[model samples]
Target chain A: MAFRASVVRLNRAIVYTQNGDPAQVLRALTYKPLPPPAPETVNIKYLLAPINPSDVNVVQGVYPAKPSLTSLVDGQPDVFVGGNEGLAEVTHVGSGVTDLVKGDWVVMTKAQAGTWSSSRNVGVLDVLKLPRVEGLTEVHGATMTVNPPSAYNMLNDYVALEKDEWVVQNGANSAVGQAVIQIAASRGFKTLNLVRKRSDIDELTRKLKDLGATEVLTYDDLNDRNLTQRIVKEWTGGKGIRLGLNCVSGPDTTSMARLLGQDAYLVSYGAMSKQPLALPTGLFIFKNLTSVGFWQSRWYKQKTRSDKENLFKTLATLIGHGKASPEHEIVTIPAEDSDEVAGQKVREIFAKIAEGQYGKKVLLKIAGSE
Target chain B: MAFRASVVRLNRAIVYTQNGDPAQVLRALTYKPLPPPAPETVNIKYLLAPINPSDVNVVQGVYPAKPSLTSLVDGQPDVFVGGNEGLAEVTHVGSGVTDLVKGDWVVMTKAQAGTWSSSRNVGVLDVLKLPRVEGLTEVHGATMTVNPPSAYNMLNDYVALEKDEWVVQNGANSAVGQAVIQIAASRGFKTLNLVRKRSDIDELTRKLKDLGATEVLTYDDLNDRNLTQRIVKEWTGGKGIRLGLNCVSGPDTTSMARLLGQDAYLVSYGAMSKQPLALPTGLFIFKNLTSVGFWQSRWYKQKTRSDKENLFKTLATLIGHGKASPEHEIVTIPAEDSDEVAGQKVREIFAKIAEGQYGKKVLLKIAGSE
Candidate 1:
């Protein structure tokens, strides 16, 4: 059965032929046919995918999940899938399939289902039926599963942010941070957002404020020795901040740690700088600060079906009512070339993400125009 | 006013005078008169004092709290008091004293009260009335406040341990660890205790077991690579350990982090090894582990008086009934000591503690036979 599909046939990928340099690698490929889905799998017609930091980490071989190599034409497996999550429409259900039907929009709910392909078969348990929101595009739905859920879970699970309480999160302009700002604001909680100083600082601050941030400050502002003390005085009326969410680690974490009130929690979901978290002993001992880490994928796996359902319902309602929406930059790729060109495009987008250039999510539009 | 007291008037205490050398600082001191109690104070005659690891830490200048250097004579402090807590007899009441009367035995409830004194003035709030326990001597009553209260609060403040559930703690032979074992045992919860290997490993294991430890293993035994896997298999019945209490950091903490189940908490109260805790990212992300640091003094200050009173009552009952007792090595020091000499003795004792040489607490006996 020769079906049209984009393929990385052999031992070749946008190779980084050199170390410690970004310019050495460009997209190139050898050739192979796609493997058929297993008995309990369903074939998905790729709809949309997003380029995330984890994808970049995988390309650089620094991620925890590594791709296995297989021999191609020259007994060398040079091709591997690159994306972690994406939205897809079920095209064919295998013999053992019971729940999913054709035309259903689904999201990869577990590890190992790469969504960069045009058509790929995955185990039924690995995919979740995404709740339909009217007028919600595949691009928005694709990027929704990871960051929005991360923001939602961290806020709900760790500490219940009361209507009057405040939440402070770094990377305010990133997808997750933006979701946090919107969700918190809609729930009647205030947000103290932090972001790096960009050329359009005023505009960026205004945009975040419009999205529900009470106060927005640049990283440079936090460098002041008395910044923590000042922020606490102004925002909390001398009560001190209760919850701090950090994706950027390093000495910045130390500053965040100092700002938290007694018995407060700081949850770090990502280490963008790849630096060790050097926290002071005084904060932990004197203030009773709790430094915790959060990974959305792991958290989702541990949650019960009812919990996931509740989250889906809440998030879907928010999206349906236009209370929260992801800011995404969508790049359309023909469905026929999704597998080969989409992965390379994702790697390129991820490079920009790693450089901290993108203001919103960089998405791949896998399906043809509706 | 000539008050009979044993005093070290000069800089000659159990002086090690050398690093890595044995404790050769035990010495006698002359007698001196103490000043009269202030208007808002009560004069207490020393009854009993316990030597704690923190006291040892203080003596070595490694403790967070440093005594003020105001009582010095000539170039050095002449007479000083050195003991964190002890049972004392109220010998005289100050002019404004209303709640306390002479002949009542009281315990110094505050952190700074030096109990190794024949007669010293302390505020009413700094003392607690000691209940009459038939076999509870001044020695046993003297050491009651800190450890038992610490253990009680740490266990209760975090996750409430249910019957048949497991609680794990390192440094099982320490005062706090023993208290946890006994308290948990009484509550019908099992404990997995860890300890460093000693000459009397078997005997120590037996003693801890007798004190309510379900399983006691030396550090070497726990250092196994598969120790966490084995612990999960045996203790949790493959469910995973719930609560972890850490006093020793470094790799010991790393082990505890690995053994915990999802959403489990690892609360560290002490750093006996003086090494920073190194936690792996996997534990933080996959296991949903929370790392928290605890300081008893901070917690005590933060808690309400009623809470403290309840904890004290429960602890007093436990001590009175002989259900909980801290092991100690008594070292009699004169009540009257020159500030420099007394401080020097404390420093020496604390240095030995930091070296991990002393298996038992070094106590100070004042105004009485050793």
Candidate 2:
């Protein structure tokens, strides 16, 4: 038998050599492809990746976890890969790998695994093989790991919120907030969503309601204390707001906190408003409220592999039942693009994010599986 | 046997007919004596009562729980009693009473049972008879139910701090703070006490150290980041400050909250600053810290009779070992004086409290027990 022939393919990646503005600090490189996977390793073809706000922060070097910079990729400056969340297909697998095979779909398990590349080789444990559902799209699977899990854990983990119990959340238009609404509705829990007022308030409210939000209100509605009290009284049946999810801090945080019942928990996952959480002293003393932080990344680090898989399966079942779906738009990236062209495209997308031009999650489609 | 024919002795109590400043709203009144104890009732002769801040708030009608206004006390306006905590001796028991005789010592178990009186007729269940200890002075026993139990529960209930672990607290000079320092020391837990800067910083530090405080620093010392970090590192041996007791709020709250390790709890029992607790957003988000409130009165309502006795016994054991004692000054109220003269004396003591002239706890010695 003749020996197998080897073929060389050029791999391109977006990276940053130093932390700064993404437009100024990020670059693209075309380099030699990975050699054959060693034992316990797999080579993957990048499919779909989401350009999350946190990904931008990672490029700016402001994120808590940073990607590893390396000199392994020749003809390029030592750089760290730019994205944290993405979908990939295993194209090759080493002999010792037992959990995955060629053609299996996977996503990066460990954060900062450099998913911004067209293709890469990683340890089998570095990626989690996802269970395929008949109608599960790559966009849903690509973005599912972060925001959906965050919302899911926040709802189930904190207080023992029974059926029909109410949860309140601000930033209700964000991806995580929308997922919380749908998931809570699926679990027989009601959600009170607070969104910032805008020209399209009516449109946004309708959109969130369509996603199964129990009630949607503007920040102005929160100031109408009598109205808020009436609504809460009627909706919760005097049980009081049990759980609060705060991403937009400042006075908004205090308002939501005030609405909570005795011993209620306010789990904050993000502070998008750049404002500090101003909690009133009386709330802490009189209401006996508890304010805490939740980081899905930290939780991920603590959970076992089967634990994660079970959670993913639970999410998949919800999606399969048509109870949950992420609103998103895909921006396709050419697989054979030049270094400069790809870097330019990445910058433009980030600029749009900064400008708040995109209302839904913007995902990157590289190998075109979506 | 001679029945000891009944004598009508006048009962005097401090009362509040309206809610406002303590000086203007409170009054002293002499009223009709108890006819006799009904079955399941007992008559208690008051010994000592401590003036707590909550008592003042209750009289002002600002507190959540309020005492019932009534015409039960003859010759007095429709009003409520002026105190919440005190030590008393059982003077008479009803036919159904099995737990006590005339000499058993007890304290009010329910709040707003009109404790600040020379004597009271109540259901036997309204007071909990304490197990007498040889050296358990009226001063310690009268004050034990509030500050000591508060410090005890806040230490043991919230966090499972192991030996050699650390707790940080502001208001180290307050009654609860002093109790915490002593109790934690007895349990082999170290404390980092934060007090306000004063002209006698050295003297106050020495006094706290004498009470088994691991380290005592002024609020200015908290601002000295290097010194604070070094002290925490050395005292905790890197376990980090796991529990924080906050009474004084405002900026001091944020500083103490910042000192805690990951997933630690800051329990706010009082806001002595009268300013709201101002917590930074990052502490909640990054450190996973929790801010909550502790109300001993509420906790008392939830606990069983045995639960309270166990805690009291634990505290008495500590006190018996000279491990804990409340820093206090005794103010005598003449037992044989007329109502008007006793009222004048009560007003004088309250004036001293308002003027901040007394540094330690002020206990009313109505019966000269201590």
Candidate 3:
């Protein structure tokens, strides 16, 4: 089988023939590599791809975005390569492409654009050229495309939050949450963060504070209404929080939302609790609260290419300036590993991500071991 | 005591010196009438004021907007007059008043402006002169300031609903609900209304249907998702409702919101259920559902006087052309009613409104009987 694959130089991609438990359905498949890019296309070598929580849901067939089925993996009639976000290095540029060339680093502009493959032929339109960055790490580049921009856009999109205005958010230990803390702090805004209570609560609070959080509390802190009220009084001086970011829903989100003032907005991007968001109807009517949502994928789909480029440029500049940096972990698949071993590793990492037990965002480095 | 009270031909105004149940805290107090209106003011005789549910909450001191404390009732050091909306006649215009003359119909321009009074000394800024609306009844004129405009604005505010597009709403038998049906029908939009199941379901459904609801559903219908699916398929050709008007929340509204399509909005104007709003977090993230609020009092506070006058004119025109008429019942306080009798009547009507047992809006005719 290896000798047959070598006829065109084989490529390995994470594949799922059907949707279900990622462990049962996902595998690494070897297939003949792309012959060459057609005009206005490029062959991209995926350097790193992050295992986002939403990506796990996609594999489970529970997410709204469905991955496009591809027949390029191991001659399968139907296969879906996983991963929505990653950074890539252009290996070959097809004729008629002017902007990107070999050795240029870029990111995928399409939603669920199958980024888990070691290498693939991609159209120029599907790739976004990245601005040069100083001291950029592989982890930041791979994960920045989703979480950092998600935080940045959410901070700017809903409310023109003013200086000294603080944002309240739950799931403050997530990658996006850290980015929110850093970005908000750099913009002169304060962040009130919430994470689940854990045995290592003090350590997590210290880490979040190091990321620029003004205050880091736990879901357990919500029970003390007086404590939250004091935050409003001592921190905000009677002015309430104007924006709230939610990922973990249910009682935690409900409690976080209470800190919002009149005409405030609560933007939801994830449902980590797997439970629904609930709030008092009086909040909407009396406080004039607005509950909305943000999906980075949707933003990518709607925004112009330049708009997306600008977003990345902004985030990169912030990173270079040391104002913000995404916190993540890299899980590399050794080059000598067999397809079965690689696939098993992918499933294990994803399970950890789905359970949210992994300390930081986990990015898959499939190109080879460092 | 009666002879002494006639010293200035005493005027009666609602007085709630402390906050509690309307029955316990509210009273009609006869105090010395104002000598005259100050400059740029008028002595207006309140013709009619409706007992709104929020007013009951206001008397109970539960609503966000606080009634201004005044000492004009029974010489009380602190008193809050009961109504938020009503129609009045300019009985005696102040010296500097030019736009308003004797007998010109007007509505209060200020929120919680002590509308539940037989007569009050008010500045011209506190009142808005009415447009000459032909065939306008006291019910439509008195009640139009809050509910009709609420329905009208709510219908137009959130979504730019196209013709044939459907709007879903709970509390379909409410005064605002009827107005929503009529206004939407006039504008070529469709309405899917929800009300609680009642012994007279057919009668209520027929009434709302006559007001131009495309379909009238009860909270019970929400149990059968298939029935709602059928409505989407058969009635709307699979296009889901884009706007949901929620006055009741909790599970009933959660089900109602499920009928909404992607990128839909749920605007809450009232909380009749006295419960919190709750929904699946996935809806906000996946479907991009937005939950906001509509408070007519807030709208009135922000909009320019002409902007407000235009809204009233639009509704008045609709009423004049037989496009709509506010559904209301008159509870007249006879000219000879003692303060005790009048106060008791107001409390009784408010109790019914609070319980949602009143068939139609109850407009208090306090100036005199026919």
Per-candidate local distance difference test: 0.68, 0.81, 0.83
lDDT of 2 by residue, A1-370 (tens): 1112155566777778889888677777776777789999998877778888888888887777888886647575687878889888888888899999788889877888787777788988888887788777787788878888899999988899999889999999888898899899999998999998899988988888888898898877888899878866887776689899988888877777767888788999888778778777777777778888888888888899998988988986776565456768888777566678877888888888888898778887653111
> In model 2, what lDDT does residue B353 have?
81
TM-score of 2: 0.91
Tens-digit per-residue lDDT, B1-370, candidate 1: 2323444222222322222222333233333344557887876776667766665555455566644322422454343344577788876678877867888778866774655555566787778777666667666678877777777777877787688898889988888899889888877888989899889999988999888889987767766858768888887888787788888876666666666887788888877666656665456665667778778777666777667766767777766776545667776554455545654665576567668777777676554221
| TM-score of decoy 3 | 0.93
Q: What's the true lDDT of residue B256 in model 3?
A: 91
lDDT of 1 at B320: 73
Per TM-score, the best of the predicted structures is 3
Measured with C-alpha atoms, the lDDT of residue B41 in candidate 3 is 92
RMSD of 1: 9.3
Backbone collision tally, model 2: 0
Quality of model 3 by C-alpha lDDT = 0.83
Runs of candidate 3 exceeding 4 Å displacement = A1-8, A73-76, A321-329, A334-341, A344-360, A368-370, B1-9, B73-78, B323-327, B338-358, B368-370
Tens-digit lDDT track of model 3 for B26-92: 8877776666678899987888898877888888887888888887845448788889899988777
Give the TM-score of chain B in candidate 1.
Answer: 0.80
- Candidate 1 CAPRI classification by DockQ: acceptable
